[model samples]
Target: MSAIVLLVLGLAAMAAGYLVYSKFIAEKIYRLDPDFKTPAHEYEDGIDFVPTNRFILWGHHFTSVAGAAPIVGPAIAVIWGWLPAFLWVVLGTIFFAGVHDSGAIWASVRNKAKSVGSLTGDVVGKRARSIFMIVIFLVLLMVNAVFAVVIAGLMMKFSSAVVPVWGAILVALVIGQLIYRRILSLPVVSVLGVIALYALIWVGPSVPIQMPTEVMPGLSGNAAWILLLFGYAAIASLLPVWMLLQPRDYINGLQLFIGLIVLYGAVVLLNPTLVAPAFNTDVPPGTPSLLPLLFVTIACGAISGFHGLVSSGTTSKQLNRETDARFVGYFGAVGEGMLALAAILAATAGFASVADWQAMYTAFGSGGVTAFVQGGAYIIHNGLGMPEATAATLLTVMAALFAGTTMDTGLRLQRYIFQEWGEIYNLPWMKKGAPATLLAVGSCLLLAFGAGGADGSGGMIIWPLFGTTNQLLAGLTLLVITVMLVRLRRPMWYTLAPLCFLLVMTIGALLLQLRTFYEQGNIFLLLMDIVVLIAAILVAMECAAALKRSRAEVAAEPE
Candidate 1:
């Protein structure tokens, strides 16, 4: 009903849960002892493992979790009405996401910073480790592929004018780094960089970039754009982290934070009337029921399997103290919940009329590119003080930049996982880092090219497949965390609540996808859904096996 009421409640819940409940979990249950030597300390390295301040680690954790998923998921879920979406985000964060992330960090700390995969093996069973790794690689592939489409769609719609906004942001980052971290005592350059960023926001529309035309031939604008995105990801992964991914994330995170604040302030100031229905009484013909669909639709904002990747991959290794993991991991989930709230507000508040909203929805319903650009434009113009056309273009550019960050990070993570997979499997070509890197790059290129040509329409097929795959990964992540908690001998109530909730929601959603595919008879979608369903079943089985092993281990030990 009232947007403000929902906002207040959601924000308050996030704060209290993070501050009070999370702290209790960390100190009483997990008992995160700072003196306990982490795997980072045991295997100290300047590159991946080094003790760092909690504040900076929070920044890293926040940036990793806050990505295109939050924006896209809420933007779509709000179609059902903001109430369901809002409730899911708030409650999910408190009961599911916060617990999952915090528990992951605690488990890693207790187990010498070994990854969730390794912990799963030790606690659950050796077989779970293999299952976890395979699941992770598949998840990363889908994540990289989907985000590639999202960014490319934005580029195609806004390439004519918004390129320079992204360029300006990147340039500002470079200058900031040079002045603050490199040149020392150069406040003037950093100040100038900030000014330039704003100036680009003002004058961004004048900058020219190539726009897709009919003459391009074969591929639609969306398809061609996505291909280029995967290409960029492949190259970005091969380079050093500092050169692209981290710097870009820093800039994007700041921009995203500012944009969200502006949008929320405007919404409160205007107090726009909600035009969309409180609930869509009549479900769309092919849509699933709200029960499971809502859970699948709002993966990133509520709970994501990908967070575990970030938690164990780099964040765990950089933790300054075991206790700090609670703040960085749990609070970071709350931060993402806030972003999802922003998206819900934007979607529900800014529409001028129900008719206008419906028209836009119908036009864009089948096209991910259309929905994203139009939604971005609506938020900028109606929720922020900006000209409609200019705001739309700016929003498109921002989307592209945000997608760029996701792609770069996804690609790098994928490469690392592939190399690990190779080593574990004893692949001859992947014994050395250089050859493995090349193989990873080549795999990315091939995937990109194949995605581009997969459908006669270029890359449209990738969008839905990406969504399914991403959600499946989230399910896998939930399974791993559930098993880890059980192995660590956490309270049964604490471990089983989130575990059962996610399992039911995810499996229900997967079955729904399978039904949709069977009815539509779309071979590609049908195949993808079948595969995801099988993967979900395997993940469940793996968790069960882990639980049995943990029980046996506990029983065999002398009491």
Candidate 2:
């Protein structure tokens, strides 16, 4: 029940996975060729397809995929029990997430850095690609919209975070030039970047920037923040990858790792015993059953479909060498696993007693990033002897930075989705970078304002579907990878096993949510769930057909 015990076990398992299992998967199963030309080098575009150093690429991939989900998911899932969430995070990261993420990057790299959605057309079928793209779009839409709101909410709620959150971007721009232009050595620049970022965090509380109560008539402060977030995302998306995205994500990645170290350090020093039970005998009345929900609830920390998106979408395009996928993609999964483990430790052990833990989880869907930041602040203060307000600002800035990086990547990925659609349907405008980015940002805003009304909070209305839809996409990503393995006549059991397990669990969870939505008369979510279910079914059929065709082609070849 000691926090250190949990932390040590999770860290050990993930380290072993990265060191041993990922190596095996990369060499034996993936058969990665060191000399194979990666898309980054082959395409050699300055904007989207620049070959990147493995360390910086890993930072971008890590922060983009880390987002708030890993923290939020495990933080919330602990309501079921810390033990279940912990085991899933440890096991799923090793067996499911690592393999899937690296496999996705490998798949995309082999196919010229196409996204998982586009790779589906080549590996699976065109029809499968169409369906897969829809699912991917919906997931991106939710991610871009909801994360904008999430970041804005955090900025509003923690005004002390405002300076650090905004200041990090300026620091990133300078670091980006320093690294890309080689004006400064990377080690020195990185150390300086981290130092500058932390300096901002130190100054944030003293000079908090609160949004005006009304930016204008009919626009509250929160709504103005949302608009500004989307505006920033739109600009960030259109900018070249190295300028803002890579450096920002990389610096954020550096600070977050330090943040995690602080958290894990706190637990080791204070040795807070878990107050939440291993299994909650006294369940919250309205909580869903644990079986399938746990899998979806703890989505990113364990295995998120979204990670596959990032792996294939952005990370694959920037891979310096084919072999770097293991370091960038799989180890990135380990980084997130460590974060989720910290969240579990924070939520379960941060509280003083069982009553305190129970009070936080009075209902399902409670205890997300707020729980993580508050609890993490407590541990930091008690263990590290940091002031509570300082500790809270630190954690808040970390969470906000994480969310902001996701929006940056999400908007860009959504832009890629539009460009992919253009390629599929032979539309010229959607293929253009500016137009695609506009469509990407435009669609999310439309959903926000069109659906949610004045406050631009409509994204929250469909937020519940994000977990289920994300899981479904992960399964389909694996399905596409499995089909590719079969086509190449590579051994696929390792990938296939997780794919099957996720599909079964996710489909079940989706159906359960569907029924619940219908019964509750929540027509919007019910319909969204049904649309996702249909898309999943159709894509599965296409992939199955593609799989059979691939098998026959392989079988007919003379040895």
Every model's Cα RMSD, please?
3.5, 1.0
Candidates' TM-scores?
Answer: 0.87, 0.99
lDDT of model 1 at position 429: 69
TM match of model 1 to true structure: 0.87
Residues 1-559 of candidate 2 have per-residue lDDT tens digits of 7888888899999999999999999998888888999989898889999999999999999999999999999999999888999999999999999999999999999998889998888777777777888889999999888888888888888888998999999999999999999999989999999999999999999998988877899998888999999888889988889999999999999999899989889899999999998887788988999989999999898999999899989999899999999999899999999999989998899888888888899999999998898889999999999998899889888888999999999999999999988988899988998999999988999998899887888899998988888988998899988988887889978988987787778788889999899889999999899998887677567656777888899999985
- Cα lDDT of candidate 2 equals 0.90
Q: Which stretches of candidate 2 lie over 4 Å from their true place?
A: none
Overall lDDT per candidate, in order of appearance: 0.65, 0.90
Best-fitting candidate, scored by TM-score: 2
Per-residue error for 411 in candidate 2, Å, reads 0.4
Candidate closest to the true structure, highest lDDT: 2
The residue pairs that clash in candidate 1, if any, are none
